[model samples]
Target: MSQTINYQAQSPTHEIESKPFDEKNQVEHVNDVSAAKELSNFKMDAMEAEKAEHNMTVLEAVKAYPWACFWAFVMSFTIIMESYDVFLIGNFLALDEFKRQFGILDHNTGKLVIAAKWQSALQMAGQLGALIGVFLAGPLTSKIGYRWATIVALIAMNATIFVMYFADSLPIFFVAQLLEGLPWGIFIANAPAYCSEIVPIKLRAPATQVLQMFWAIGSIIVGAVTYHYNPMSGKKAYRIPIALQWMFPTPLLVLMFLAPESPWWLVRKGRLEEAAKSVNRLGRKSRLNANEIVAMMRRVVENEKEGSISYLELFKMPDLRRTLIVSGVYAAQNLTGNLIANQAVYFFQQAGMSDQTAFALGLITSALQMIFVMLSWILTSYYGRRPIYIWGTAFNTVMLFALGIAASVGKSNAASQAQASFGLIVSVMFTFAAAPVGYAIIGETGSIRLRPLTTGFGRAVYYIVEIPCIFLASYMLNPTGANLGGKCGYVWGGTATVCLILAYFFLPEMKGRSYRELDILFHRRVPARQFSKTVIGPEEDE
Candidate 1:
């Protein structure tokens, strides 16, 4: 048989390898080069697809989800209107027409002072409302959901804007303003929370900063419109700007219907499937698989479990206590004289500018502010939160100090133009540095689990400080002119200086840390000054 076999037809190795198996069962190894080539092609395809879907242009994404952009715009628009309303009053009140209409030109000094004080007083009421509203927002949202809470706040605030038209007496306007204050706090507390929570993390900074821009935009529009319309005509000329306020929020309310509830909130309520769908809508829908979605919910649920709903529990846990403190510090960031800056029209008049020049200057200042804020938004990602916080506050402190001296001496100097010009330059710089960082720090300092609570606490601090500052500023400027601004400059300058010390010593670089990681980092026992390095991943935090 061996002699007859055609041994040349097959190798002994091949024959041995195939001996145990049938023809159909014979195995073949794939070429290593070919297999690797196939895998590389597949990976490239996946990355390309991901980039296409996830890296959407802002315009394209807006078209796909108009509500997202619409809500963002509305939030921004409202702030603009607020700025316009506040600043316009200063210019109008300083005008001869406004004083004459009220029949007090002869002894207008007292009336003018009272008007400023009254406005500031109303602002104080609103600030008080803000403090209370922010403290209450967390529980209210938990009970009523963010959408409803937003609607309620908007309604209350906007309604007051409408009522301001009918306010004939100072007392009536005062009551209306106080009512208006309540909703302003609610809006401040909830809107950012809503906007920040819903937008995908990658776009968080821009979205929130855009809200700040809208506020600036509102200020600009208000300045321009009021310059032309002169809201103090005493014959309903003011209706146009005031009416615009009511008009802007109308569509915003409808847009909320399209906005899905927060997935974290949904999960907190135990609607796991709905939470997945909500998160998917915010994300590139196709990329998130069931397992990934479930994993996200599970982590959120675990965090919530670790963080109870009770306000009492907030102080009980070391992490929560740290979170509260960080958020409280964040609130003080707003206190660095930006709101007072917004009332620049009034201050300019006090600095001895004519009514028209004050309004025009207000416009110029606001436009510059808007430009700086946009720039800050870009730089925050490039430069990180710490650099902005440090440089911004430091520069602002210098400006505030310079402003105080300029305001103090300008009236007698005949170089009032130069002094006023220099002071204005410093203010512009302060606004430039503070605006973007103001919006950025709201979310950065706290854990993911503590976002709502901390945001509420921060806002509460904002309005609380805000109201008193406005009234004090009004009283100082109205009664004492240069002396008050000088003192304010000194006080605010010192405050900014304190902020600088805090920024260098305590404020951690929260620029790039993940929500989970921020949670762990803030919980460390190290002093806030050393937090930058002592935390396990200082570099990672940025």
Candidate 2:
């Protein structure tokens, strides 16, 4: 004889009543149906409870996790070195001193310019090293942990800066650039993951945006330093900026030593005790429940372990879709005219602006980008990720098209060239809104067990995509090659259109979803548009 069981399903919005199941008197068919209904109701109640625990207003999360925010700000300083390096190289191209040191004299124009091959090589070498660094970050971090990996990378970057400072020849400088990229590769690949994991769900997007904001600040500083120093003759102009790179890494190295290792990473290594301690350490100011956080982390880990996904599995079926989205979004950001726009000083000089004017404009551009990135933090925190990417892409597409039109029509006139330059600046501003969000999304999208590997793979894909895109951009913008000038916008504008469509169709609303929630949503094959409306809990199985 079977006994009756009553079940209740409670949802945040409403409660569902399940009738009692009676097996002794009822037919087997009726009993079985009742039993199934009761089981489903119980699962629903568990899901609702899980979701409620994880949900918090953004303000509440911030007030709770102030220390987490402070740590994220500290970690974000890593990107300043990266942005400084990028802008220093571009601004140096317009510097007479930089040209004298590494460039060949253009007899026709009586000016010095870096040879096209050398320029491309200088750019590609760093990217190549970065590619290797990103690929290696997974194993390194998994073995030694994120904090140690960062320290090692920071030390390597300092060594490379010293090499760049003393080098008299381009070959040595090129090698230094390449070697330095390894640390940047590791830092960029892992910093977002570190930031995302430490913060509460509501603060994740804002915390990640902090990295890009510092990137802009670094760019601005480089522009100012180059503007003042580049006019002076000799290697000192370039060396001063290169030397300043040490300022960020040195202090960062000290702080990282004191920083807590990621609790999630600790959990992944079966160091639950340490992970719990870390959760408390990191979330101490937030007053978060350390035990509850650890339990939730354990559930996520157990779920992932049950799946037993291999690295190769990342390229197969469900996981492959995620990899593609993560990689594709990163790759798409490059194609949005950032490569060409980043070389703003060079492009402006090519358009006939005086060197001083070009550098000043570049400084303004960086400042504007910094402002916009801060605004993006607010917008993303309030509005969600998908809308920003959608509208930002649309805005960029139109600006690029208009800039291309402006350049083509007024290529010969200073007024038209200025218009084209202004258009590029505006386009870059729009990009800031969307590009930073991609970093957050990449960190959020990967499975916890496979995150390091998947993000590494995604970053590798990003660099690979950037190689050709950078090469093409260098050719089109460099005077020795196609010299499309602003007309190059046509190429990027078309690519942006395609990326916008892909984002609309494929990128889900990961706005406030936790990693565990995202895992269940992906495993269940929820449509991208339905992510926000869909409620998920730990009880939901793949």
Candidate 3:
């Protein structure tokens, strides 16, 4: 906590001439008279409660919010399936069994390869399907709530899992990926929002970030399974991986049925009693009062003038800024060369590593990604979201350029080895930096009333950005196509440079802020960098 600095307004026109930098306690004082006029007694109570809740140490939070932690994890568990299959698509290209079944023989290289157009198409199909699903998730989640929406999505996912399990041809597999993208879209959007809504301010970062950890875990599972099966012949190699996706939906469906609906969602829908009950369940060990927290949730929903929960609201004044920031940061995920990293098994091979080495390196990097995601939670606890993403993207940009240099130096054994090392390093760096933190930022950046829509729209933006990214990755990495191999890093490095600039300007510090404080800061039009330093103690709505 910084010194207890106060904001005394000399007049209505007098601005806050001096500001104190407080990263952990963004709203420590409530002395600006004009700002005070914005704070009702109820709002002040809400802010104070938020401050105390956010001030909880990680241990205190873990002890107090066990239910929140558990249910949020349960809600996100199914995302592992999405990541598993998404990982499989890229890694399978390197598997002889999958290639024999699905890929055409490439005469040019004497290798079996999934054609570049089809590779791009298959990836784009998922993103396109996901884009449609993302927009649909907004209204569906708003109507039925996150838990039920997830339940519905799980049912849809189960059907698609069967499609994937039995797919024998490329066309059928494409259709399966496209359809499965729907629930994956719903899961990605819903998990972060659910985690953010259920947990206290202190737990929100780690909770939302768990999505990335799950993705890494999913990748690890696929890597391990595929590596074991790589030596096997015929359909079992690819089919075993597809069959395993069935493991996700059923278990997660049971967990979802047992989980609590988001209290914030309940409050927004005017189910105060249910919201309070959900809050009580989630916060059974907390020292705070559920009723007071419900009131705060109510105030926050109303303060955003949330009547317009539709997508259009996202394009309006304050909400528009939040939407853009959320969209840009999410877009940055793709721009930072995720395709190169995510498809490292195939990518490393083309850069000259042996198939065995490629598989081993991919598995090693997936494990590292999972480990780094946990480490990122520690970084998130100590640093603000802006710095993590900005610096993370910056670090990734440098690594991308380095990878390009290694590839440009020629595919000598040492150069190929350097390329392989840098590719994995980029993946690990991205995992530590922007990857996990992006989840927390999106959940916190949007308006409370439009939280679902905001996250959905942001994800929609990602898929939109992903379409070209997938196409580029397919063409650049496919030996049958441009086959740029490691040289592809130069292209993504340029994009990452752009992403770094956007994040520095648009990303705000959402590390320690409650929904209420964030709503005020955005409404006040505080610059992105000033979010941590500018104090706006609980403020009233106009």
Per-model TM against the reference: 0.79, 0.88, 0.91
Instruction: Flag regions of model 2 displaced more than 4 Å.
Output: 1-53, 305-310, 412-420, 537-539
Full-model lDDT, candidate 2: 0.78
Give the range of the ten consecutive residues with the poorest summed lDDT in model 3.
1-10
**lDDT at 26, model 1:** 40
- Tens digit of per-residue lDDT, candidate 2, span 336-394: 75776568788777766778887887888778888888888888888988888788888
Candidate 1 structure quality by residue, lDDT tens digits, 1-542? 67546564456767877787654444333456667886555444433433332455444544444455455545545455445555555554554444444433225345433355565665465456556777877778777777777777767766777677676665665665566666665666665656665554444566666656766676788778778765355545555655666766677767666667766667667777887787666655544443344444345345433646655655655556555555545555555766456667766776667778878888898788778778877777556667776787777787677767776664564544654565566556655555556566675454445556766777766666666677667776765333364446777787778767866776666554444445555555556555546434311211
Which candidate leads the pack in TM-score? Answer: 3
What are the clashing pairs of model 3? 38-540, 39-540
List per-prediction Cα lDDT, in the order shown: 0.61, 0.78, 0.85
Candidate 2's TM-score reads 0.88
Of the two candidates 1 and 2, the one with more favorable lDDT, higher being better, is 2
In angstroms, how far off is 104's CA in candidate 3? Answer: 2.7
Task: State residue 161's C-alpha deviation in candidate 1, in Å.
Answer: 3.1
After TM-score superposition, the amount by which residue 78's alpha carbon in candidate 3 deviates from its true location, in angstroms, is 2.1
Best-fitting candidate, measured by lDDT?
3
